[model samples]
Each structure stands twice: as C-alpha cells, then as structure tokens.
Target: MENTSTTLTMTRRFDVTAEKVFDAWLNPEMMKKWFFTMEPTNKVTKNDPRVGGSWEIVDHREGKDYRAIGEYIEVDPPSKLVFTFKMPQFSDMEDRISVEIKPVENGCEMTFTQIIVIPHEEGWTEGDIEKAHNEYSSQTEQGWYYMFLGLKQLVETGKVKYPS
Candidate 1:
C-alpha cells in the first residue's frame, strides 16, 4: 500500500528578476552552486531544461554519495515549473514539486510546494509507518528550508558557502 501526504508549501521572495530566479532553478551551472545546502559539492549535474527533460545531481558528503533524479513535467520559463523528484535511497517513493514565480515590484515572489508520498513496507505497523512518515517529512522540510536560504544567498550576494 502507498499513502500520499499533504502538500508542503513554502514561499520566499528574492531580490532578483523572475527570469533570473527561474533560470537559477533550471540552469545546471547555477544549481551546482546552491542545490543541496548540506552537500554543496556535487560530483555531477545533468540538467536539460525543457518539457519532458530530465535532471540528476550526484553529491558526495561525509564519504557517502547521494544522488537525486527528477524530470520536468511542465516548464514555463520565468513563471512556473513542475517536476517529479526522487532520491534513490527512498525505495519506491516519489514526489512532485511545483514552483510558481511571480514578478514583484522589488524582485520576485516564489511559491514552492511539494506533494510527497510514502510507500508502505512489509512488516511495518500503522504506527510505525506514521512515525517514519513524520520523521521523513520533518527532515525534508528542514532540508528545503536551508536550500532556499542558499538560493537566496546566491541570487543576492552572487556567492554562497555550504559547510564541507
């Protein structure tokens, strides 16, 4: 059995143009600079910014290599992007991420949301599943929070530092 979780929404305003912000998300070079805050160093990044295109990033940290893969579902340059995201470590679990960028007087407002699904594993009770789901949700939320911070810093200051 598989269960879908509630949508997690995050909003942030960046002091950059909508195109700039959107490009940063799709551009491989820009993303390499600030994709994963915890593992800022990526071994490789392959991004093809177009509908039906795929992207992947491999990160090395603490002597372990983690990889995330995603595909573009919808791409509206400078305005919106929808994608499917998954990390291989999570067995049979995938999520959808939607990003909406709106031009503001100062810069741009980005509304981000991810719809997550947790897969059921054999021998796990209801309580155990819920507990695992909650823990994963919390950690995911925190990771994105910091990743956004890195994105903002990169857009604003033109540089970012990720702990090594």
Candidate 2:
C-alpha cells in the first residue's frame, strides 16, 4: 500500500526578536514552558538541537504520559528549523514540520508548516483519504494554536499565561 499526505501551514507574528522566537523551539528549558502542555511543571523536555540530532518531549497529564519524539533535519538559528515528528504510542506515522522565522519591522513572524502522512489501506478511497487528512489537520491546527499562544506569552513576557 502507498501513503497519502497533506500539508497544513500556519503563521503567527510575535513582538519579539526572530532569534528569541526561533530559540523557543529548540531550547529545552524554553520549550518546556510552551511547547506541548499547559502544565509546564509536569512536562519533561530533552533536546539535541542540531541537524541529525533527536529530541523528546513527554507531557504528563491525568496520570497518562504523552510522548513526542523527533529528529532534527535542519537547524538554522534565527531563521528556520525542520524536523520529523512522531508519537510512537499513537501511530507509526511520521510527520515533517518546518518552522521559518523572519524579522519584521516590529519584531518577527513565524511560518510553521507540517506535512502529515498516513498509510493508505487497501480499501481506502479518495474520500476516505481526504476525510482523514481534514480531521488530522484540524486537530493539529488546534493543538498548535494553543502552543503558539503559550510561546508568544513566554517569549514576550518571559512567562506563559495559560488559557482560562
């Protein structure tokens, strides 16, 4: 069987330097504050932020641990980062994500793109693949929306403000 893939892109402007926004994605200390979970205290982040290096983040929620593991494909400070993302507990599918940061007059803007790929089963039709892509993209977008909120707060104020 082959595989189907879809791309989702999101952009956010920050009132901070490009380097600061870019660093938030790689620095384990900074990542724990805004990367995955609202409860930073319960999150563990370990990163080797370089090309070919690997990173892992585990968020402990409700007595369950959610793990995201990935390998860095490209790391360009103050500019771009590309990585492969996978959650072993959820599925064997691996996704590629690229984050590009550009300096603007006020601060900076980040463009994040994720390519989600899933295996195509024998009985799956075009509609089936499209539906799966839509669902996956929606969930991923929602998750990143919250994460970007936390990232903005942390980078701009040196702290995160959890949503109420």
Candidate 3:
C-alpha cells in the first residue's frame, strides 16, 4: 500500500561481551529472564529464540505477540547479527533489526538498531504518533538494556536473577 511507511529507528549501546550479550537473545531460557516483563502482570505469553523464533508477552498495560520469524540475514557469532521482527497487529510492521558487537578490554560494546515499518495509522490520533514512537523506543531500550545487564551478570557471576 502507498501508506506503508517506516516511522522511526532506535539504537542502544550495552557494555558487555558480544558473545555473552548475543546469547541473551539467542537463547530461549535466557531470554525469558529479562526480555519482556510480565503483566501488571500475568504470565509469559511466548518465547522462542531461533532463526524463525517467536515470542509474546502480555501485561495489563500491553499485549504483544512478537514474531521474529525470518531466516538469519547475518550471524557472525559474537560480532554481528541481523534478523526480522514482524508484529501484525501494530499496523503491519516488519522491523528489520540488527545488533553489532565490538570487543573491548572490559567486555564488548553492543549496539542495537530496529527499523519499524507500519502499514497504516490504525487507531492513532493526531499527536499519538509521537507518543507511540517514543514509547516504543524507550520500552525497547529498557528491554535490551536489561537483557545486556542480565547477560553480564550471568557471565561475570555465573548466575542469573530475574527482576521482581
């Protein structure tokens, strides 16, 4: 459709090793620990971490069934990764996501970027677009940040703890 458009892109950096950091996303059990916080909240909806991986999280505030079902565009093991994220309910969004890892003395620097494409405005109002975009970016940033932190805590300490 002519109206299909990509509105925003967000990037966040994490302080951790690329290997450890990537594992948090690639590993199913590990991802559940920090990926999506429960509903105000209920149970974990869905969580899978593979090339055709899928995930869904439900809370009183938001209900999202994340579908990252695409062949790995690129996988460089601890160095770089690329995948697709599609959420149909949110105006036909097909997000092209990528992560880059750079090794550092302390650990690794992780940079994540997500490009979200929307088909229609759907129920959004006048200024709602800004709010939606900002909220999405912030929420994703927090999720990734927590993932990195969890990954770091796990590798550095050999234990993983979920947020309460």
Q: Evaluated with TM-score, which candidate comes out highest? A: 2
TM-score of 2: 0.94
Q: Model 1 scores what on Cα lDDT?
A: 0.84
Give the per-residue Cα lDDT of candidate 1 at 66. Answer: 81
Q: Encode model 3's per-residue lDDT on 3-45: one tens digit a residue.
A: 3333333343445566777776666555555544322343454
Ranking by TM-score: 2, 1, 3
lDDT of 1 by residue, 13-106 (tens): 9999999889889888888877752335588888998999999888887788788888999999889999989888855577999999999999
Model 3: C-alpha RMSD to truth?
5.1
- Worst 10-residue stretch by lDDT in candidate 1? 33-42
lDDT of each: 0.84, 0.89, 0.58
TM-score: which is higher, 2 or 3?
2
TM-score-superior candidate, 1 or 3: 1
Clashing pairs in 2: none
Better of 1 and 2 by TM-score: 2
